[model samples]
Target: MRSRQFGPRVSKDGVSFRLWAPAAKRVDLLLDRALPMQRRDDGWHAVDVPGLTAGSRYKFRIDNELEVPDPGSDFQPDDVTGPSEVIDHGAYAWRAKDWRGRPWQDAVFLESHVGTFTHEGTYRAMIDKLDHLVETGITALELMPLADFAGRRNWGYDGVLLYAPDSAYGRPDDLRALIDEAHLRGLMVFLDVVYNHFGPEGNYLGHYAPEFFTAAHTPWGSAIDYRVPQVRAFAIENALHWLADYRFDGLRFDAVNHIFGVRDEIPLLHELSAAVGDLATETGRHIHLVLENGDNRASMLDSAEDPPRGKFRAQWNDDYHHVWHVMLTGESAGYYGDYQDDPRGDLARALSSGFVYQGKRAAFWGGEPRGEPSGHLAPSAFVNFLQNHDQIGNRALGDRLESIAAPAAVAAALAVTLLAPTVPMLFMGEEWGSRRPFPFFCDFQGGLADAVRKGRRIEYEWAYSKYGDEVPDPLAVETFKSAVIDWEARNQSPGKERLALVRGLLAVRHKEIAPRLPGATFGEARAGADGLLTADWIMGDGTRLHLIANLSASELSPPRTRPAGKPIWGGALTDRLLPWSVLWSLGEV
Candidate 1:
């Protein structure tokens, strides 16, 4: 029953319009013609128009100079640069009205980009594939950001209208149907939201309310001034709107490390979590929140408590991915350089603790101490993955690990990641080992388009020198099409084999590990110089989950003592582990 403060308020009586524009001297509500709005002392513009109902389109005129869509617009039918259409949030008749959500422990995430998920690339198109996910054992679908951006083919990160679900996909109802269908199938849908910074184009807040941003800049754009009370309310309300309006089961906050304040204060992240926790309590829904923070601040995660109240459920464990990548592909560019020296050892640490850094001095992080002690947190506090959008798209060729590394190695890595007690995620087509590339693509025009092209080339100068224009263009239609996963591959040769492997791993995870995840505690892990890895975790039911892996391409002799548990995966204990071999077992304590 909470009302949004920034957008049109619809009721049986009429619609009340409100805009927070302190910088603008005068504001006009644009329907058929401009109507002057009454300016409040609190720097808010208000106007009431009776009989203005849903399906009506409107915009705001600032000082009779520039007209802009509502920053809180429900739907941008004409994209981010056009007029906003009024939408009734309560109008949708959800079929799964009784559905609350699944527990965090049951989550096996499939992170996807809606635009490139299918050949049709629409919300309705995605629904047809929900059964595929269910059969593949993906209990949760984590979508990339859906906020309206300037172009038709963005990764959804350049969202300018925080409230509008990009019209390029489909209508608001269509998106609702996707969630509704997903819930009916017992799949929890979580949205990836960007609160750190707005996209470069189609953001009109600065024209009327310059105070919304600080002079400080993030890598994308100006840092939002969350210090302001109105600015703070805007973000919190946006989070609620998605959860309440569309009935999303949870949210994954993107790169929250960039959401910094000029002065030290209570973080907006905490406030947002508290608000969401209150909603979960009121609705009795098991809503979850995850963060993609580079800082690795273990203090923020608390998966120890059931239904995780008043804290984040988990964080994306980039450390786990980095070590695996270095060991597999031998690529040490960028952040990968940090793990190159002791990748096996780092992998051991990641298995034993939630973070590989854990307050250790990171050579890649400007030689500064990174991360906090996290061995005490529950094993589920980390979301482990082999690949995600950023790891793939940010590469020069956007090559998947299966494409660049040996298939056997990637499979071994998956065997370790998927069966572990920590929450596991998969990139869109990772289960089937689809070779389709997910190169970065956007639909910007003119100067902005050119800037994107040049920036990519500059960032990948080595690729530019060698490939020389063969590198995928971020603005090209072909680039977007190339990222569309080949669904047919799931039924083919090696794809079929890989699919079966993942399906079996997830089956075991849900059957054995999930029930015991509640009291799962971190156990010790050690990697020998001869490519032998020994790790274990104490499950909730007092069972010890054990793992032994030979990450190297050369076969290695086994440790003196065999794992105690009955074999869950891999064959019986052997004298030697073959190249890229892994073993998982659960033992009675």
Candidate 2:
């Protein structure tokens, strides 16, 4: 029988194995027999185990004191910290042979937690929901973090085991099955990965080796030492493993602001981007890397050369969501304070420039000014959303946009998100106006769980005391259960109406705007001094579209330059649009 490739398959004759051990002076790869790998000039230890079969189990001995799992392990069955299992990437029976990658611009993201997206909360159960998403016109699905986390019921963000797929969600093969099934249905899958920091529980990196982290402290705890050569190799190799082994089309990086590397250097962001790009070229597959940066830094859109654009395909535009939310809900606590007054200009700027805080001082951030995005980047480079896992789950009660705003306001926001220049995304329940509250919940056991519960309650109570209203306790089982979407509700009249409206808006976008895709031009119209704004898109084929919004409480007159042809949407042109109403129209200018 032919021997299988043991590590990353580079070419027919070459494969690479990497391990992360910063503190160790010497490291050896323990293959079928103990083999001392030669330390490379670049700080990685490697050996070509070409004759070794794919199912071989291996570990690493570092400085004669620690035997740790492979940092780039393809499989880890004996707990997350044990020895790794080498598997042939080509062995899995893939059913998605004709799978073509879904573009970031083509995606309508469905963000949901595996624990609550269905009653079973397993990968298999999620596979059953693919038909619904496919029919709903979503081309891609963004799953919340699913790395092996402690306990069974917590959100996947607190995940500690980066190598092991959560056993609770069914084994590694199960996740592969989920991706394969999704691809078969013409839906791309993007996994939300937490790289800036690991979760609090089952995190055995410290126990095995000190090289996994650095002296720097992050909000989540110790930061990964990306500046260290071995540490960088480990991070990059793990990302490659996910794409090559599991066939994930893309990765949505969580909290990239915390990824601090060497100053005056390319930084890990650019390094990973280049690495992923190289791998994509070799594999002939379209792979995307997205960043979620709270800091509105324009440098993220830079290319590989010069100032070095952060090397990411796209980054989440929080400013757009912040402006939209504040305008509709009229809430100004916390981060919303920066967008409290005259948010129409901010919204219009976000639609035109892709960043609302461009060179503007943020009030909530205390004199910190955000930079503008490079004008050359396409509209798809900015991922805009009014609701996401963070925006909903981080709230005191996890109230969705529909919970806090009127139905008309919610519909307007949806239209704006879908029709704007930036790529649009929708949170799971937002489409049907689901009443569920996606509150924060975890399954930490014993003292840890109790501490989390107490801490969450204290935090919500403090918000209630200051904000003038009590919020729901996050620890309550009812809170988490309430977040489970009522799939049956989609059949009802109100739910169907909301879904149809979204469908209509998306139909207009896909048919009219998206066909123009990267070359569409944008301009904005102001409705007097009250901050009511309208944005227009002129397609490559001379087709004109307009988005008219009334951000203020009262209606405003149309802009001075009215379209010459009949309005495609009559509801938007009617007099006196109530507070927070938005309309989309197609006509000739």
Best by lDDT: 1
> Count of backbone clashes for each model?
0, 1
TM-score of each: 0.98, 0.85
* Tens digits of lDDT, candidate 2, 1-589: 1121223333355445665444466878777677777775545566776656665677888777778776455556665556677656666798898675765556677877888888788889999989978777777788888777656666678866565677667767888899999999888888888888877766656754577688887666788877765567556666766776788887888887777653335367777777777767666677777778777666665322211123776778898899888877888877888887667767777777677777788876677775565445666678889889878877877778887887777777787788775778888866777877787877666777787766665654533455333555455666667778788777797899988877777777776667666555555545445746777766555666787777556667655555554454436465555566776677765
For model 2, the superposed segments whose C-alpha errors exceed 4 Å read 1-19, 22-70, 75-87, 262-266, 302-310, 373-376, 450-479, 525-531, 552-556, 565-581, 587-589
Clash count, candidate 2:
1
| lDDT against the true structure, each candidate | 0.90, 0.71
lDDT of 1 by residue, 1-589 (tens): 3567978888887788899999888999999988899998888999999988998899999998999999999999999989999898888999998999998889999999998899889999999999999999999999999999998899998999999999999999999999999999999999999998999899999988999999888878899989888998899899989998999999999998888671264458777888888788888898889999888988888985444455799999999999999988888777898998889999999999989998888887799999999999999999999999999998888888888999988999999999999999999999999999999899999999999898878866644556765788889899899999999999998999999999999999889889999889999999987789999999999999989889888989888888787888887779888998999899987
- For model 1, how many clashes? 0
Model 2 TM-score on a 0 to 1 scale: 0.85
Give candidate 2's error at residue 94 in angstroms.
1.3
Residue 129 in model 1: shift from native, Å?
A: 0.5
